[model samples]
Target: MIHSLVFLNGFEREITVGNALVTSYFKCGCSSFGRQVFDEMLERNVVTWTAIISGLSQNELFEDSLRLFLKMRHGMVEPNFLTYLSSLMACSGLQALGEGRQIHGLVWKLGIQSDLCIESALMDMYSKCGSLEDAWRIFESAVELDEVSMTVILVGFAQNGFEEEAIQFFVKMVKAGTEVDPNMVSAVLGVFGVDTSLGLGKQIHSLVIKRSFGSNRFVGNGLINMYSKCGELQDSIKVFSKMPQRNSVSWNSMIAAFARHGDGFRALQLYEEMRQEGVEPTDVTFLSLLHACSHGGLVDKGMEFLKSMTEVFRISPRTEHYACVVDMLGRAGLLNEAKTFIEGLPMKPDVLICQALLGACSIHGNTEVGKYAAEQLFLLEPDNPVPHVLLANIYSSEGRWKERAWTIKRMKEIGVVKETGMSWIEIDKKVHSFVVEDKMHPQAVIIYGVLAGLFRLMKDEGYKPDKRFILYYLDQDVKHN
Candidate 1:
């Protein structure tokens, strides 16, 4: 159309005609063409400048968008709310914290901080840059915190591991009488993982039901995730059954919950059910299923499912899928096959994949593979101590004390200290974590006394000390002491 206009009509087009063509191109997402028209214009107004900047920003050319903003300033075009909003969005996309701060100052100087769109964009910018503190400050200082600002701040806190802060603001939002939408709940729930507080999660779940957000797929998925992480498999299943709609995430969550609980059979059953229900399994779903198979030692079942991932589902196996296959093979004591599989992988095996093989080697006492895996893992993550520890354990089990000592010496030289294993149990909403020989607890003395009495009773019943329980440092004198 522009070519026809130039060839038949003339090269000399009216400013209004050029602007209309540019606007049409910008609307059609042809920012480059709009920019060409913009360059050809003899007189560029504020609207013309804003249109191009907005177009560039929308197209994700953030730096170019920002550069255009600078050009608008050089041309003495006074920016309006739309100009600032577009620039702020560019800053948010690029996570340009310094530029965003400059924009904040400009907004303040222009006395447009109270403008909802500008303020919301500022909040989103800070949040996207991981500056939750700044996001919260803007949110609190806003004359009116709309749902967009509130949800952005809430999600920012949650994603940054400030779960407590997120929940607090959530309550305050409720008290201030802001309507909580499913999107807000979904954003908050996305950050709730295996380590989140179950009680707090339950409160969120109850709120979802009370607010009638339970019917929302996002809310339902959040509930499924929260229940799964809380170790409430039954509740997770209940939520799954009641969900009016189920996405791949819902199925994956249930499969993951069962896998985590070591109920591989049930996980497999659900996988099959998911197929029967016509909900296709995703990569994550297969990963969870593979984990279940590995843990339950279902070698044949695991292999079949792994094959189905590529053949039946037509999903290309990624590094994570390969890692699971290696883990499953290693865990089942198919050491040679595991090594061959890793070597045969199109992509290089990552440290986690190698570490999985090392763990299996430790359990099966395969010193050869364990040593090789340890070497590879050490090269990948020199600071990690697990590979060294596993290697030491393998040598010790094989009665190769000299090799074990050498491994420990190398670890010491590298300043790698084995982290003591700790287990935690949540009781009555409080978590209690303990390490072996931990004497810092108030009830440590009483717990030791009970253990001593139990040991005595076991000794009287012809029980003997399992040398496996003793640390390498524990000698006769230490045991007596």
Candidate 2:
């Protein structure tokens, strides 16, 4: 095809045709061919540069796209909206916050910051790069915010764990008279995953129905996930049953919901139904099944799916799948088998896999194997404090005071301190965080009083605090006090 194009119009003269050929080749996934044509071009314009950069970004060749953008700047081609858009996308993919900020500066320098599409893309880039503050700044500076712009900001907020802020912004956008689209609704639904208020979820569901977006597959799937994560299995089932069309995501979500709730029989039944409906199971589908088997003690079923993943579906099990198997075995008290599985893995077991085994050993008071897993975790993630903490807990549970004391000493010697446990609640669009025994809240006295009252009532009702969680270094008198 290149030969034919070159034969018809000598490459140097037909810059337009050459640019078209580069774009066509890139669109066809022939990036090498596109580069060859781009290299052969004697007269490269902004369009040609933008075409290749956009193709590379869209195809997820982010580094190459950024490199070409650098070259384009050196080539003295001033970037327009398309160029900035593609480059910003590449920045997002690579999580290049510095480069994205530089591009934002370039946008201001070029006097194109007013371009809504470019502004939206900039917010998206900053959001994906973990600069939510910068993204919010871009959004606040926008003269006229569109639905796409609002949606990107909302998604950014959600992805960055600013759920309350995201929900507040959604409410603010609606109050400002911007028409909400399916994408925006989907983004809003994500907030519910973190904020597990059944009342709030149902209010959103009502809004979805009123807006006639109830039938949207994406929205439906989001509702299912939100409900499941919130521990409302019935609501998730309700959403799944009401969806007009069920995709693999919907099926997998419902299956996972049941599995997570410890109804492995129902989860397996749903998987069978999904297969009968000719909706193929994805990697996520198998993950949910394995999770159910692990939690529900259906180890045999989990093993069968692990084998069938490769043999029947021709889908290679990823590290996550293998980790699930290890978790299942460990949880079922098959500690030796789990260790053997890890040793025999085709790839190195990640720290999370070892952590799972270590956790299971802690629960079952298997000190010997737990110690080995903890040591492996120390090697895998030297700076991580979890293994050290968990190992100490395991020793404490088994009444091995000396070992627990040694573990604590080793943690201090290695300069590995456990992070303080913290919790947060979002109230009226504001998030308030508190650490253990926090006294920072304005109403801390009242809150503490209420908590003390609840603790007294719980003790009266036969609730007992587990003392094994306390550090063994502390004296028994101190612990009692």
User: Could you give candidate 1's per-residue lDDT for residues 221-296 as a string of tens digits?
Assistant: 8888778877788888899899998889888988998998899999999988998999988889989999999889
**Residue-level lDDT tens digits of model 2 in 343-410:** 99888889878999998888777888898899899999999999998888888888788999999999
Which residue pairs clash in candidate 1?
Answer: none
Clashing pairs in 2: none
Each candidate structure's TM-score, on Cα atoms with residue i matched to residue i, is 0.76, 0.84
User: Candidate 2: lDDT of 178?
Assistant: 74
The list of candidate 1 runs beyond 4 A from truth reads 1-124, 136-143, 164-180, 188-197, 307-316, 417-421, 451-481
